[model samples]
Target: MAAIWIAQETVDAAQGGDRQALESVLAGAQDQVHALARRILVDVEDAREATQEILILVLTKLSTFRGESAFSTWVYQIAVRYLVNAKKLRARDPGLTFEMFAADLENGLVADPPKAPDQDLLLNELRTSCTMAMLLCLTLDLRLAYVLGDIFELDHSEAATILEVTPAAFRKRLSRARSAVHAFTAQNCGLVNQSAPCSCPRRLPAAMASGRITLNDYPNSGEGADSFQAVKRRIGSVVDALKSYELFSAVPDHRCPDDIRHQLTEILSPNI
Candidate 1:
């Protein structure tokens, strides 16, 4: 949900073929674009590729910006369009229903397992992965609505503009998405319902056993990421329907790879 505002003058300079200005524009847009791509697309690699493609689209279409909206909104419009239509990107597994996920949660909970040296990091990874997979259970449109309206906390009008829908329509879609997620999590997630069968610690063992989580590559791991205690405290402060969403929002934004800017620089150098 972090955003860097691109000044209109900077946008104009970029449009006028200023390479540094262009890089600045794209760099400002990168984190947000990647964040949207990461949530919309399931795979990490797929999100990266899609983020690059969306930025290229933004670049190619730069001249068309007539300044009718904020540059960030314009960027989001392009990103939402590309992501919604990028069918070739990996689709969620056909069998990954709430029922299946519930069963998975129930199957491998270590009530009192020995702790690892990096328990917090591993638990963060598991929580992020599990919640992301939960989003995939919703259909693409619903998922977009939930992520934009709920997790990112974008205004309904703004989110509607990005999705090219009316505010009321967006709200309806978001309501559906929220209901589905809320229902599932209320019954299953320990953060939402303390008596629930699954907690991050309980599921860590299963996640590792299934190779869903590995120490060798911790995509969601980061320094000072929200700890389980912090997440629980936040959850306790929110209403029942919103606790699951609070948990989702608590996951750290996946950092965009540094090399993306370097790659963009290389791609734009010839034109410069």
Candidate 2:
């Protein structure tokens, strides 16, 4: 997916104290910021909260933006700084390890899982959740490197700028993250390795039983979506290592919740 860029004119107007321009700037940034937060933070609620706080920081710091970078880059710099530190505030335990995740994938899988009314949707939910859990296996710095450099497809220099690290340092971090993810998925994920034991269907029952596949709260649930089979067919030809990263790119882009604008407006009401 292409990165969303806010027009410099709009940013300028917002910085000049135009309320409508400010709203436009924030609206343009909301989804990308929320998506970054979602990728970095394991919990949906924590991501949402972090997005709000990050946007607020952007608004407050708008005057400090000197336009040395693209507006999106500047916003992302703020976001990464906040999210890297905010990991500690996450409600979910941040102790997930690759060994633990691999074991979880192998545990409680049913030979022939019963069908759900919306099996495709449920499976998609499980697949997205499982992939996200895999990300949690990485440490905060490595996870951010993978999310920005690999999953979001940001350029190494740009991603490094966002993280305030030297390009070589960022590359090293991304390399480590990629190796860990590739090693684990190549051994355990059916999508990457057809010989692997853990397929989405076989794991759906365990996911449902563990309350990790709730239908109503599915982050990627939408109409006219393809099943995992269709998704597999689309990316089946890619090399294994790239395919593991593509799994993340293939998941639908997550939108900021509907009430976010309203909530932002409420929070900024006194100033606006």
lDDT per model vs. reference: 0.83, 0.82
Q: For candidate 2, give the lDDT.
A: 0.82
lDDT of 1 at 67: 91
Model 2 spans > 4 angstroms off: 87-91, 215-217, 221-224, 269-272
In the range 117-157, model 1's lDDT, one tens digit per residue, is 58877887787788888887887889999989987888889
10 residues in a row with least lDDT, candidate 1: 87-96
100 Cα displacement, candidate 1 (Å): 2.6
Cα lDDT tens digits, model 2, 1-272, are 45868888988888887878888888898988988888888688888888899989988888899989988889999998888666456446578999998898999978888888778788877877788888889998999999999888998999999999999999999999999999998899888788889988899888888888886667644422667777777657788688887777677667888788667766773474
lDDT of 1: 0.83
